[model samples]
Target: MQKFQELSQTELESLYHDLLGKYKNFQEKKLKLDMSRGKPAADQFEISMGILDEVNSKSSCLASDGMDCRNYGDFDGIPECKAIFCDMLEVDPEEIFIFGNSSLSIMYDAIGKMMLHGVRPGAKPWSRCEKRKFLCPVPGYDRHFSITECFGFEMIPIEMTPDGPDMDTVERLVASDPDIKGIWCVPKYSNPQGITYSDETVRRFAQMKTAADDFIIMWDNAYAIHDLYPDQKVPLLNILEECKKAGDPTRVMIFASTSKISFAGAGIGVFACAEEMMARMKKLLAFQTIGFDKLNMLRHARFFKNYEGLLKHMEKHAELLRPKFKTVLDAFHSQLDGKGIADWIEPLGGYFISLNVMDQCAKRVVQLCKEAGVILTAAGASFPLGKDPRDRNIRIAPTYPTIEELQQAVSLLCIVIQLAAAEKLLQISPEK
Candidate 1:
C-alpha cells in the first residue's frame, strides 16, 4: 500500500525520524553477510548429488543408437539428450544441439566464431561488416553485454518495457541500421528482472525486417525450467515455434542449460536453431573438435530420465529456494516498505532482484554495505559496460546464502540505503 499525496511537513519529519532510527540500528549491528552472486546456495546443491550416481563405470554405457557412451562421435549430442533439451525448449529434436557443460561457454564460443569468421546465426559471415552494433535492453545480463563488447561491437541501449524491449525502438533501429548486428534476450525469467517476454514481443522479434540480412537474435532461456512456484510458472511463447509460425526459422538462435537442476559444471548445454542455421553451425563447430563427450550427455539423459524428471528436480530446488526467497522479501517489506528511500522487485523465480534507489546513490550505498561487511554485486553491473544509466538499479542475489545471512544482509542493505539517501538529500537541501 502507498500513501496518498498530501502529507504535512511535520508528518514527513516523523516518518524520516522512524526511518533514521531503523538505519542507525542496522549500522550498529555491523553484520557481515553476502547475498550478491546468483550461484546456488550449498544446500541447493546437496539435494542433487544423486546425479553423480546416475551413471557409473560398471553401468552399461551404451546409447540407444548402439554407440558406446564412453567414446566420442556425435558432435551435435546424442539423440536422447537432444530430445530432452528440445522438450525443455518446446522444439523438435532436429532443431537441438547439445554441447559441453556451460551454455555461457557455448554462447562465448559463438561470439568468438562470429568475430573471426562472422557467422550470424548461420547466415552470411558478418566478417563483412566494418562496424558492428548490438542492441541491449537495459537492466540486462552483464555477461551477455561483456560477450558482445569483447567482440568490439557497439552496444546500443534500449529501454526495457514491462512486456520486453521496446519493439518500436528495436524494429526501427534494426530495420534502418545495417550496422546493428544482433540483440541479446533472456526471454524467460530473464536474469536480474525475471520478466517473461509477452507474446507480442516474441512475435515482433520473429518478424523483424532487418536492414542487414545477417542480423541475428540470441535468445537465452536459462530459467526455462527454473520455477520458484510450480503452479505459478511463467509462460513464454516458444521462440522456435514462433519463428516457424512466422515462416522465418532462420531468425533466432536459442540457448539453454541444466546448470541449476543438476551439478552446474557437469551439466549439459544446448543450442537450437532452424535447419539452415544448424547446418551452418555444424560447418563452424566442425572446425573446433571432431566429437564431444557423449557420456555426459548420456549421464544427464539417464539422470533426468525424461522431461517429467527434469520438472521433478526443479520442484526440489523450489523447496530449498522458497524459504530463502521469503527471508529477503520479508526483510525488505518489514524494514523498508514505503520508506521512499528504495524500491525492489519481488521476482517470482529468478536468481536475482533488481533494486532501485535514488539515482546516483547506488555506488555509494553498495560501498557503505561493503564496509559494513556485506558484499554485493558491483554497482552499475545491471546495464551495458557496468553502468546503470540512472545509477539506481542494484541486483540482489538471495539464493546463494542461508536465510539468516540473507536476513542480516537485507537488514544492512536497508540501513545503507537510508543513510546514503538521507545524506544525498541533506547535501542538496537549501533550507537545512
Candidate 2:
C-alpha cells in the first residue's frame, strides 16, 4: 500500500519486476483492445435505432414552415430544426444554422472562410495578418489544435485550471496582441477533462477586451447535454448570451451536434451566433452549397421533438456510458490509487478520462500497453502539435469497448503504468 516514492531502490526494483511479469502475462494473452478515441460502443448505437424510422418515405417530408425537406432552398435550415437548437443552446432561431453530421466540418469551414474573406466583408483577412495567433488551452482537444495548426496560426498554450483556462493570462495576451484572433473553448464537460467553466471564467471571456476587432471565441459545446448523472447536471453559462450582455453580440460562434446522441454519422450539426454573423456565414455558404441535408435535420427534429426530449435521449446514453467510466475509475482506485506515479480526473459527463502519469513516462506506458496488445491515444496528443511539455498526460477513452474487454485492457494498462513508473524511479534512485 506504500506510495512508489516511499519505496527504497531494492523495493522499487522488486515492484518493477512484479509488474513486468504481470505485463508479460498480459502480452501472452494476446488481447486486442483499443481505447484510442472516444467512440460510442455498438450497444449505445442501438438506443437510437428508432431514429431511422422517424423519417421514412411514407412520412410527410414537410418542415414546420411548410417547405418540403426533400427539396433544396431551406438554406439556413428548417424552422423546426432551428427551434430545437434554439431551445437547447438558449439562442434565438435567427442565430442558429443547422448543418450536416459533423460539427467539426462546420468549424473547419468557419475558420477557412475567415482566413479567405476575413470576419466581415471589408476587414483584413486573417491569412494576411503579419503574425496570426490563436490561444489553445493545454491538455485540450487535439482536433481543435489541429484546426489552428492547419491555418498556420501561432498557437499559444494557455494553462487550464480547474475552473477553466487561466483567465489572467488569456485576458492579458488577448488585450495586448492584435495578432491573437481567437480561442477554442469547450466550456461544458470539456474534452479529456470534464472541467466546466466557472461562471466567473465565462464572464471574463465575455467581457475581456481584445486588440483584434474580429476576435472570436469558438465555443464548441459538444457535451452540453452529455451528463452521466441526469439529476445532477452541470450548467454551462451560455457564451452567446454572455457576449450579448457584454455588448459583443458577434464575439462567439457556438457549435453543437447530435452525433453522439442519435447517430454519429447521420446526426445534425448546428452553428449559432448573432443574426449579423449568421448572415455573413450564410452568404459564404451560398457559394459552397445550396443547402445541407434537410431530410437528416427533419429526421432529428422528429426524433427529438424538443430540448426535453433530447435530454431524455441523452439520459439513455448516460446509462450505457456510466458503467464504462466506472469500470476504469474502479480499476484505478483498486490498482493505482496510492501509487505516486499517476493521477486522474473523475469526470461527470465527458467521453474521456484524463490521466497524468509520472513525468517523462507517459510514452513508455503507452508503448508498454501497445506491446501488451492494448491501444491508447498517444501520450502527447492532447496538446498543440502533439507535444505535452511535461510528457505526462494521457487521454483514456473507455466508451468504445465492451465491459469485459475494457476490464482486461484497463488491467493491463495499470500494470504497464506501474512498470513504467517503477522503471523511471529506479533510474533515478541513489541506491541503484
C-alpha lDDT of residue 5 in model 1: 24
For model 2, residues 216-237, the per-residue Cα lDDT tens digits are: 9999999989999988898888
Cα misplacement distance, residue 217 of candidate 2 (Å): 0.5
Candidate 2 has an lDDT of 0.91
| Segments of candidate 1 deviating more than 4 angstroms | 1-30, 120-124, 428-432
Q: Estimate each model's TM-score.
A: 0.93, 0.98
RMSD of 2: 1.9
- Pull out the clashing pairs in model 1: 118-126
Give the worst 10-residue stretch by lDDT in candidate 2.
423-432
